[model samples]
Target chain A: MNDSAIDQKPQTNSIISGAQLLIHLLEEQGVTHVAGIPGGANLPMYDALTSSSIKHVLARHEQGAGFIAQGMARVSGEAHVCFASSGPGATNLVTAVADAKMDSIPLIAITGQVSQTMIGTDAFQEIDTFGLMLPITKHNWLVRSAEELLEVIPHAFEVALSGRPGPVSIDIPKDVQNELINFRPKSIDSTDVKAPCSALDENDIREMLAIIKNAHKPILMIGGGIIYSDACDDLKVFAETLDIPAVQTFMGLGVLSNEHPLSLGMLGMHGAPFTNLVLEECDLVVGLGVRFDDRATGKVSDFCPRAKFVHVDIDRSEIDKVISSMYSIHADVGDVLRAANNSLQHVTRPLWRQRIEKLKESHPLRLDGDDDLFRPYGAIKTIASMVDDSANITTDVGQHQMWVAQAYPFTRPRQWISSGGLGTMGFGLPTAIGMALAQPDITTLCFSGDGSFMMNIQELATLAEENLNVKVIILNNNHLGLVRQQQTLFYKKNLSAVKFQQGVDFAMAAKSMGVNGMNLGQVDNPHKQLTKALREPGPWVIDIPISETEMVFPMVAPGGSNRDMIHGEEQ
Target chain B: MSNENQSLLKLIVNNHPGVLSHICGLFARRSYNLEGVMIRPIAGSSSHKSCVWLLVNEVEKLPQLIRQTEKLIDVITVEQHDMKESIFEKTEQFFI
Candidate 1:
């Protein structure tokens, strides 16, 4: 289509309501959909959505709405919107909002505040939403006037997406949402958001380069910050040029194409066996955008005991917050990559490359090289192949999260989103809800461990109500797989709180929520069931009943090197 | 370990409201735990930013803790200067 074919200019000079202005601003920012539940306090806003072009999904609950927005934001790399009424509705959205804030997903939560007259009077369904959401949000505002709603609505989106990216909120009084005010939409500038100072210190950069050049074994640990900064290409190039072994955190998945030789899968508690081993043995660790979370480096004192760190991050506070640094570069990963590309000479290290190859062979993630019945690897491979390169995938924390990280072949950045630092359970369902809301056109897959899936199982009702086409894969081992594996290794098979006498009937649960569900993993013809689920129109769940005895291998024991892996039960 | 003049302190205080604000404010605002402070919520806590344990040495800097604790409305109590006890009962793991 030609530029002239579309309406390029702002249409009218007519007076409009504040609700309409809010809608117009949201449309101007290319936002077409919202995940929310309407109530008396903001009935006018819902009524306005009917007149405006934006589509709104009525969530079963406010928490579900917030999480759906989170999924949307993570997938689209843009801010997502969610709304709730006063009191209980607003309070219910807290956990989801806090999830977005913790994982640094860009989300906008607009709550309908009580009437301005009800302020401090403690009327029915009245709560100070702005005050309640303070700790969980990056920036929050109380729109006192209808005129302020126009400015604040768009501004909230800007703050939520800019810089580090987090959830922001705006509380609109019920009266303001209903009032007809002369709407004037003006673009706001937020360029002054405190960003990491540009350009790494010259000495620091040079020192880091020298260390990389000198080290016999060097590994690059990438984190969520890298994806947030959109510096995947630079990270990939740096790793390739130096032939460094690279291990990513859970958030750092998809930073490098899974096919890349330098990509050594994930590291930490549930990380690949070789990844942890290499990290331990490496003489130098070039930290890029990763916040050395405790999960990745168990006992910090003994973590990478031999490695000297060249910690590079945009946040100055994170530099020495965890591991002490041999050289610290506080700048955007993109800037550092450009600087490194210009300064460094290509030097091949055959020995270093060989070591990486050995590590891969030693602790390869093989679900079943021959045991076709246990199809963890095959299932992951199939899922990875089936989804679009750009499709977004969120995972619940557990064995499934780790398996996906190790086996799923991601070819682009930001395709995989998870609760990395927090290892939060119940993250998958909400994030998937958000993804489907954000990218309604693209298919989203949320892989959840049976235990983790149960934590936020209630969100299924929200998905059904909203009619979101989100596909969920429940890896049902009927046990806390990771914990079970840990106990088997360390506690001499004393499995406690690991087994469930009767597995949850997810199919029935989905039906209760008015959604489609099936147990596909145990079916002789699972392909047909899985294909049907993928093609279904609304939110769907496929419970894959995997073997409970199955253990995700290449495990690194506490207080041991990654090389010292307890591979299988017999081993 | 005593030769290093470093003590790894673990204090389980009340998961009171504004407890984090006070503890962090005391450390960050007053530059008390400036060397480094890693505070994460202990697994089972209903309160917000509650049940946070701090890993710091210089437990002898007690008077500072008491004064800061008094200023914070959320802090239920202050338990500092427990060196030998922490070594015996290592409830938490310290990572860098």
Candidate 2:
């Protein structure tokens, strides 16, 4: 272990309760904020919080707390913390924890369990939190005793933030939290917690370079790993030097600015028609820090059919798990790119670039009614235009999320934060609240649809309490638009239980929650109203009513090849 | 007891309450076919480690399975062995 420790010296040979010790250790780990709710089991930890410097944001629900912490972690690129009580609190946190696991965000979820004696005895609020969290988290622990907290807490941080960062849970029984221990203050060093990546084999790097050099048409497929590894600059340089057109996975968006000449934007599923077309004809696919997710690679057998894949990721399991690669390097992508840059020569592929330009001209992403703010694409574009590159964008999963992904001009890494792998609805408001909390200076835009906004609508109360600058723009369509779209396309228009029977007055709902609310439909000058709403500070819900019939076009039907795209009627 | 279709995997893991669950959960969730499992604390070892042997019939996915298993934090090492050298072969009489 590196001798460096958290920047605090502990008091020697002091007596402290397990709860107090946990709080102190968290302080040492530099956790400034924790999002959670107090319940019967975790009251001791909550009591300990009163005497600590850390600020607690009491969320309306445990799921909100979990995503709130995720928002902070995703923005800061650090292991952040959340807390919940046993049973329902832990269960409620399941989706957010699983979301972190899928997205590889560094988060530490600490749940309070029932007393040690009551474990497995059918005690009230007693469920097997460790077992519940085991499969979803990277690692989980059930603290056996008060003394074990010292080891478990720091180790949880290490496991969560180290190689291939992910969420981890530590379940502390109420009795253990109340147990008194003779604490010997040992310096817990988490500064060097990140595991040193294994040394890259020179032969593998040489082989990857050779494949890229020899291929007639090479494309760079980047993903979330690039952002996690902080390799955006290195990736940009590598792609530019090789003159390779880069296509981002949903998680990989913002690694290259949408305006970059070589940028092909997002690929697969709801990707642009031309972007997916480019992938079909490419001879070499050099995937850096990507898993070739099913959404990004529609039909795995047909994706990049003409390309020889070269996958470089930190995790060995991701290799050959989805798509087999001709050259696979199980090392950090940033390190690999840095090494490749040393020997890389500036090369140009005029013929391949010309071919890509031709495809782009013929089959581009259709943004119908983008000039009208009432349309989905138009709403997203207008939001993007209002904020500078410093603004952070988040979304709840649905038609609105896809619209933002398709239309938003994401220019920097960590700028676009959404639920990618899990595709969880109701992810926007709380996560954007987190973004606002982490970076209070910049505006955080959450583009949510009516169906997704209602899932975590209760979190508006939490947002009201924080009073942060998070503007939630609900593209009100009164239905699960994506589900309805699929029903129309693939299910023979057999719409089942997708449309909402009752209409919700979202503006009134926000106002009832003690936050600012606005309805574009009621305003005569929507442009003026929107500009004023976005420019002002504090939380606001801007409800823009859009037609329910609109669909996200250039979509590849589920299980279909990316090449066989289903385009909507021309604008 | 040994067969051409069976493969033996030896895992050295931290001996703890939920470590076994973590290992077993991975197998179940990934849909990997696990034929049998045996686990015991490493005798006379001070480090509190255990030895686990998994008998599986997934020859094609063994490499990927091993890679996934190695990713678990509690697992110390994974070694592949042939069914001919399996501990299940030696302990067959107990089950019979």
Error of 1 at A509 (Å): 3.7
The parts of candidate 2 lying over 4 Å away from their true place are A1-10, A187-197
**True A-B contacts kept by model 1:** 0.00
> What tens digits encode model 2's per-residue C-alpha lDDT throughout A1-571?
2212223334667667788889988988899999999998898888788878899999999999999999999999989999999999999999999999999999899999999899989999999898889999999999988888887888888888878999999999999988878878666666424343578888878889998889999999999999999999999999999999999999999999999999999999999999999998999999999999889999999999899999999999999999889989999999999989888999999999999999999999889999889998888888788878899999999998999999999999999999999999989999998899999999999999999999899999999999999999999999999999999999999999998999999999999999999899999899999999999889999999999899998889899999999988966
Cα deviation in Å at residue B57, candidate 1?
14
Return the top candidate by lDDT: 2
Cα lDDT tens digits, model 1, A321-349, are: 77888788878877888778777777788
- iRMSD of prediction 2: 2.2
Task: Report the lDDT of model 1 for residue B48.
Answer: 42
In order, the Cα lDDT scores of the candidates are 0.73, 0.91
In model 1, how large is the Cα lDDT of residue A274?
69
TM-score, prediction 2:
0.97
Look at candidate 1 and give me any clashing residue pairs: A68-A433, A68-A434, A71-A434, A71-A435, A72-A434, A72-A435, A322-B96, A323-B96
Question: CA shift at A449, candidate 2, in angstroms?
Answer: 0.6
Instruction: State the displacement of the C-alpha of residue A245, model 2, in Å, after optimal TM-score superposition.
Output: 0.7
